[model samples]
Target: MTAPLPSLRARVTPPDAVSPAPTHGHPPLIEVDRLSLYYGAARALHDISFAVPERLVTAFIGPSGCGKSTLLRCFNRMNDLIDNVRLEGTVRIGGEDIYARDIDVIELRKRVGMVFQRSNPFPKTIFDNIAYALRLQGLRRKSEIADIVEQSLHQAALWEEVKDRLHASALGLSGGQQQRLCIARAIAIKPDILLMDEPASALDPLATAKIEDLILDLKQQFTIVIVTHNMQQAARISDATAFFYLGELIEHDATSKIFTNPARKQTEDYVTGRFG
Candidate 1:
């Protein structure tokens, strides 16, 4: 039998609480207002608006090529890597406009970490994989680095499995272990927002379940945004869900409502497995 769904605490703030004035003293952690993106002459996203609250899991779900990954990349300005990619309107993190000229993209990315679909661990040892980011920031204390490596691995739920093999090559790990190691690496810097782009898509079922459990556990300390095509996984893990269609935000609401009683007919049909 399937395990019972975990009791969902009321952590999602209402849409009105995410007003521009910051009502209830809880400002949104990330805000996208009338945001549009383009790759040279081709527009990818049109006028999308949403607010992601702190310390919660928000998921983006839709059919393939619906701009879910595109919008997730905008949170940390990953689109900047694409030639002539342009953004209109604003994407603000921690009340600071990320698109502003003076903003430091490197620091912005540090605050907003990401885990990609595949497990792309470095060729170095497991300990070095987790230490790579900390070392780049000029942290030289050996004791501190060791402590952080253990702490991050524990947070990612991999410490017990790999503690004895910290010196082993990361490339030798199983696919699931490598993916968890990637998560530990991302969390090592203690980012406030973690963006996952189909992070479990390449994993097996057991590995995917472990990643889902990690996502559920990590929300107490970090805000998470997940882009997923797996409807069941979205419903199981996310506190809130957003449905995108052809680069537009078709609907967004609580995960339960989105799955059971969506306000839009399109969202209902899609959730009911009628059509994407």
Candidate 2:
């Protein structure tokens, strides 16, 4: 592996790379305006409008099939791959409408990374898995790929455990390590936004804690949006939380307010375990 740099992030990222939460001058980095989605004839998301600030964790919490994951897919147009999926709202990232006809989805996805509910590493060596996307993006220099792989693993907090066996098969790792590896792979390109869907639901408590810590650290570099069924997990790692039910966004607010003093009765009930 290449020797560690003093500050790889400083060289690759600007101090104020992403816009802050809506304020006097700083606009939210991501804006979803009156968004609705459909899976064939069935509507999945109602008119959902919200803003995601930069460098913070915004988590989506809801019962199963309540459109949490569906809405997340809308961020990078991942829903487009599903047959008969249609969207009718503008999701703008960094002031550009992602649904615009002139947009390049391939490049858009490069700017927006994703981590699924399950850890899905390609059947490749650990080093190769992290380097795969970089190589596809035309990073042909071996030294550059090695350096980035090390940096990404370090950022994901997996380097200390896996540095000795960079060539090991990803499948040979434990469940938690695999998830962190997936996270490492996603961050290798340093996307402006990161979307996750129940990334730790399958893991044990200790592993989940590591993933949560990783998410909190990653928010400093990427605008993170996560969908989770674990309400406590959402409260612990997210700066803000959005509650969903039957395809409708009930309420969104700061984590503390959402849990303790939500504006809506439904939100209160859901958080209080009164109903699904």
Candidate 3:
């Protein structure tokens, strides 16, 4: 099934993942170069250029409909799923152009995982939900799959909460737990990057704080790119912040500078709550 996929050992600890990734570099792990996107004839993203360092959090913030989510969708080519979507320029992950004719979209998705604004867990038992992908990939060894499930939940900071009820339906979980389960499911396959689209917007304050803490811890292993309307959330967890307005990338810089000493007036004004 699925061509036997990669062995659990190989997928669990990829070579590059084990290597220490420098936090600074020229050709960053994710590079968006002069990129633009269009829905039919309506342009959604302007020429957006940025580089995301490995194992760090980069936040995209702006007023609603400013194209933050649209741009985030580009990282994994999720936009291609929509009808009549046209993209210009390129998005490269690990130096390979994902839009290339020979690239495999399925394989790309395995490397770049996504978490949506709302958590959507499968109706199956929690254990089955995490193991579904493994089984589909021909991983028949229960011990191996169980190990990965436990590890993923631990990484998502969910092991302690749901470990005893692994056989229960995932629907029985709280919204926050469901969200963490979604995150655990995404990370179960060992994606190099995790793309989050307002992952904590719907959670309560305490739940949101847990999620924020989880994001901070997760950045040590996975490159994270998040789209958030809550500027405070961005400021709390992101290493860098990009400001988008009217489909344009107004500024992208260190979170500290973006908040305290932004180079762009537009960024300054937006961050200060003058206008979004």
Candidate 4:
């Protein structure tokens, strides 16, 4: 078997330790079993099953509307907010079904933060943008919020650029900065998992590179699942990659395997630029 990518394994495991994969016999942090989803009458995902390892970067790569983002939303239950959305089967985080009765979505959101394709900083100061989620959870102490804000920004690799102007309006920053600020805001609440949907699709190459680097750094503390059409980006940073097609999971495996020797003809075709 191919070894785990060093950059990923080194972040959360000791050197010489076996990298985590379900096929490798390591238990997964997130489990999707025979799961299907529908938006009103239109089915979006069909019987998808996969296990995501903890503290590793998992990339979902496919063409647009191929159910990559749909599955990413399942991790945090974002689909629940949309009307007429229906799901069959189970999505389990830490072995507990998130769709089960009495699950506190607010708290679930706190544990599973999301960053959108577009940079969305509230029309507030950068400081407030990062502190909003904390405040909503009743963190009123200015010192506490300030500490977390600084830490999260550092984690997102934006603190150095904005530390001197944190109180300024978030809208004043450039597009890349705003995206990093959004990431900082998401991490400020210290989520256990992060779901990013084409987060760098709107940024220029430089900004996209920065976001990619930040993602590499983040896996030390959070399990990250990203939806991207950029096949190269998925290969660059993810430990595992899942390919979706027409609301079905066509292939999922280690990133190196998927990119280098994909098992499915469709995954091979998509990754090789034959078709998307």
For each candidate in the order shown, give its overall lDDT on alpha carbons: 0.86, 0.85, 0.85, 0.86
What is the lDDT ranking, best to worst? 1, 4, 2, 3
Q: In candidate 2, residue 138 scores what lDDT?
A: 86
What are the TM-scores, per candidate, against the unseen true structure?
A: 0.91, 0.90, 0.90, 0.91
Task: Give the poorly placed runs of model 2, Cα more than 4 Å off.
Answer: 1-26
Clash count for each candidate, listed in order shown: 0, 0, 0, 0
Worst 10 residues of 4 by lDDT: 8-17
lDDT of 4 by residue, 85-146 (tens): 99998988988899999999888888999999999999999999989988988899999999
TM-score of 4: 0.91
Candidate 1, superposed: residue stretches over 4 Å from native: 1-26
* lDDT per residue as tens, model 1, 85-170: 98998999988999999999999999999999898999999999989988976789999999999999999999999999999999
User: Could you report the Cα RMSD, in angstroms, for every candidate shown?
Assistant: 7.1, 11.3, 11.3, 7.2
**True-structure Cα RMSD, model 1:** 7.1
Q: Report model 1's TM-score to 2 decimal places.
A: 0.91
State the TM-score for model 3: 0.90
lDDT string for model 3 (22-92, tens) is 23552378888778889999999877777788888989999999999999998898988899999998889
Query: Worst 10-residue stretch by lDDT in candidate 1?
Result: 1-10
> In model 2, how large is the Cα lDDT of residue 58?
90
lDDT of 3: 0.85
Residue 255, candidate 4: Cα error in Å is 0.4
